[model samples]
Target: MQENTGAGYPGDAGVTDDFALAGVPDAFQRLWTPHRMAYIKGGQHQFKNENDCPFCVGPGRTDEEALIVYRGRTCYVVLNLFPYNPGHLLVCPYRHIPDYTDLTLEETAEFADLTQTGMRVLRKVSNAAGFNLGMNQGVVGGAGISAHLHQHIVPRWGGDGNFFPIIAQTKAITQTLDEVRQQVADAWPGETDAE
Candidate 1:
């Protein structure tokens, strides 16, 4: 006959084993950032109007302050404040418009040109393995700032997707926005004769 010791059993409060007392630590390290609360809350207040639109306001500020990588006549490229990746860029038209179809012929041309140039510059500077390029049309379509039209140029690398973003809801940005902006700006292609 055996006596009950409450060892290695479920709901056993009497377990005195060291392994049971102190659970095993995970091999992975965690980066806990409470500061992201500001970013989460700030999203609601960012696009109330054209004046409040970051795409609209970014061009007016200095290159360093605005994180502007390149400025075209009708469109410009700026670094995403909350980037999916370090070199994430946004190509936005100067005119405040909600839809892509609202762009004029000139705006459309410049927008397309800037988008391609942005990808090229990002590849040159960051050595990106791939890219996630597109526009989130409206609020329902995953656009954070749906009031203004902007195309996202997210640079992706091998093994860039990881459990941290999925489990912790936190993205680890390797470089500062300014550092990435400078790198891309420095590597941007010079204006061709056709421009």
Candidate 2:
């Protein structure tokens, strides 16, 4: 802590100056997101084995509990627990494969289909103007959970980029993950229609 030498300020005399270390105020306003500590601290999202992998374990639970939007024979669409935007989604294969090349023919086909359906559902439910779609293969490739293969479908809108995400490294999600999951799930097209 800085020594309070009764320095310059309006009321310097006899004041304890508990916040002496706080220093001068600036034009920036801080947005404290305590919820993000889960990601930073390595919560359930961090998995050491396939048995605990979120993508593998998520399907065993109910759709609401898993934040799953849609299910197929070989793949499923679920809302991203740590989303870049409000309706960000991930299409993951049922198997615990670590890379895209590991997927079987059937898994590959369904994975691609589910990604398309997820994008359509996000557009219909959230009126998203654009999307960011890709897959992070391994730890070095930026996959948070590198034990599973999943494709990201991040919905985007005009002016979605703000000082918060760009400068502060924080994104302001307008809705809860469950809310987005339900909206996207309800808007999902039937199997026949999706094709």
Clashing pairs for model 2 are none
List the global CA lDDT of all models: 0.84, 0.81
Off by over 4 Å in 2: 1-46, 166-169
Candidate 2 lDDT by residue in tens digits, 54-92:
899999999999998888998899888889899989999
Which ranges in model 1 have alpha carbons more than 4 Å from their true place? 1-46, 193-195
TM-score for all models, in order of appearance: 0.75, 0.74
Deviation of model 2 at 85, angstroms: 0.4
Model 1 residue 65 lDDT score: 97
For residues 70-153, could you state the per-residue lDDT of candidate 1 as single tens digits? Answer: 989999999999899999999999899999999999999999888888877777778998999999887767677788999999
lDDT of 2 at 23: 69
Question: In TM-score terms, which candidate is top?
Answer: 1
Q: Candidate 1 local accuracy as lDDT?
A: 0.84
